[model samples]
Target: MMKNECSVVQDVLPLYLENMVSEGTTVFVKEHLENCSDCAAEFERLKSGRQIDEAAPQREHDTDVITAVKKKIAKKIFKIVAVVCLVFAVLFCAVLFYTGISYPVTKESISLSTKTDSEYTYIILETKAGKSLFFESKTEDILNDHNEVCGRRIVLYNVQYHNSFTKNTSSMSWGKPLNDEKPYLEVIVELENDTLQISNAE
Candidate 1:
């Protein structure tokens, strides 16, 4: 009925190529193509290489999109780990430094031995840890005080030879010094290599 049959052909051309036309439109185009060989030939040529039945193949490569996302995630994880480790290390070192600084200086054991007689006398003072001990001394009636005896050395005792106590003296004397606060322990003895003994008098 339409004089310009090509108008129907053109209208159905797009829908026919896309395979989206209804069955009625397809049948109508078939009838029109039976009379018009030009559009039919054109349609066959247009559809020769192209297939509407098949969809496009999936993409081939990701182009580093996934890799970039992974890299960003890995970087964030590494930064978090680094921050945590750094904080722990700093806290641990701070605790250790604080403990070291606040710690007290340990005192060592002190051992002193003294031997006295009517003659020459000697004393050996030792520490358990090879460290120094708090000690001070005085002679005769020099003032013996804690603050005064810190770094000063005093004569232990005086020994007189060829004088009183002409006997072998091997005696230990434990007495409190009237001047010093600490109790005094004195040992009086004479080695028998030459001649020695003890004197228990008054």
Candidate 2:
């Protein structure tokens, strides 16, 4: 009879710890544990194990929540960095499109003329009508056989943007006087693979 009671108490111990056993079963198990040393020791061990079992899931849940939060934060940071890089790339391309020189000056794109005055002879460069273009001019001295500076060499570059935001003008002109002592014999417009030289003949 005592052996049977011990077995029943042990079986109901887990349910009792979880408060699932009825009050009558609870009283029976408690009275058996109070009297039997072996049953009391077994009940204490089961209670300690149940406490640890209950805490393990809470710890696991907390770790899972932390891991999920970290993953979400990482995803948000990646999106922000991606957007910033895209904006920087677009701005960099826009700067290149607006400021970079695109084409070389050509005869069909401009008209060249010379204006003579009492003191100086002016070389005139003008863009053709309805052209949305600008010019960059670089001047170098023409060298003779002895490396002497004989005249000036003017090279013009035509600049135009690829976008429609660029404003069109009827004409734009650049005029500079030829030096009296060493007159420029050539006004060169640099093409893609060749050059067009304007005759300075009066």
Candidate 3:
């Protein structure tokens, strides 16, 4: 009879520890535990085990909180890195745009001269120190009222650019073979705000 009672009490111990048993069942289990040493010891062990079981969910909750914090920190770091890279990319493109475009040079910034030999006439062009020049020349047909070509016009211009990588130079010269048959009727220098007529046949 005592052994059977012990089995019944032990089976009910879990429910009793969790306070799920009815009032009558609670009274019976307490009475048995007080009288029986073995059942009392079993109840103590179950109580300790129940405490740990209840604490497990709290520990799991703490771990989840830690993981969530780590993920947020990682996302913030990624955003900072992406923003830094975008800034550098914009600066690089700005530098390229500044260096790539060309503009007509002001007349006050350059000196133009001419040197002649038997075969050719050299147009000597010079820029200020630390600047570079881009020279261009073209010829246009001079027309009369009837639209007939009377002569040719020679146009000359210079554009300038400066950067750290460009060679530091002050002067450049170009020579052209003179055509005796169609002697240059006029030579015009195109400046930023004005035109210079260097030579005119008329």
Candidate 4:
């Protein structure tokens, strides 16, 4: 009878190896395999076969995880490169705008002229390059006050260059009488030496 039981256990060993046996059957098979060498060897053979099937899917799962991680790293790298390129493009455009809109001019290359309109007096500056800048003053007294720079030079605050529908234009108004809200170029002038100095305000 025990030999017949060993044969029955061997027939169901494959299901036990695959973990498809009921709990009671699993307990019975484990007890029989422990006592009988023949059934134990048969169980080892079936277990080895099932392990091959199990290992293949595990390897496939590992491969999928690796592929997913690689894709995530690739997406992050692409985003970083795109952001760096965008920043570089913006800085390049700003440099181009600065070069196109603003240039250096000395007092020798510029002449000042005054014109009277319906509301105010316009102080017009003509450059040797035929570029012009204008400033408005309510009275000649305001203009005289701004022009008084140690009796030797005139200091113009916030001299701005414009490059839009009208090209090669600049402007500055007297600060005390009326203030003009516009961007300014970073250039300082010394009338005594007739020099123009360029600087970065930032």
Clashing pairs in 2: none
> How does each model score on TM-score?
0.26, 0.45, 0.48, 0.40
Better of 1 and 3 by lDDT: 3
- How would you order the candidates by TM-score, starting with the best? 3, 2, 4, 1
Backbone clash pairs in model 4 (N, Cα, C under 3 Å; residues 3+ apart or in different chains), count: 0
Q: Go through the candidates in order and give each one's C-alpha lDDT.
A: 0.49, 0.72, 0.76, 0.58
Model 4 residue runs over 4 Å out of place are 1-9, 18-32, 55-59, 102-202
Native-structure RMSD, model 1: 19.7
Each candidate: RMSD to true structure?
A: 19.7, 8.2, 8.9, 12.1
RMSD of 2: 8.2
- Tell me which residue pairs clash in candidate 1: 168-196, 168-197, 168-198, 169-197, 169-198, 170-197, 170-198
Q: What does candidate 3 score on TM?
A: 0.48
Better of 2 and 4 by TM-score: 2
lDDT of 1 at 182: 37
Worst 10 residues of 2 by lDDT: 160-169
Error of 1 at 153 (Å): 19
Answer with 1 or 2, whichever has the higher TM-score. Answer: 2
TM-score of 4: 0.40
lDDT (Cα, tens digit) per residue for candidate 4, span 1-202 = 9999998998888788778899999999999988999889887887788788889999999999999999999999999999999999998898678545744445665555444445443444454433443322221121234453211123443333333333444444211111222212223344434645432212
lDDT of 1 by residue, 51-99 (tens): 5334223121354667788999999999999999999999988766643
Clashes of 2: 0
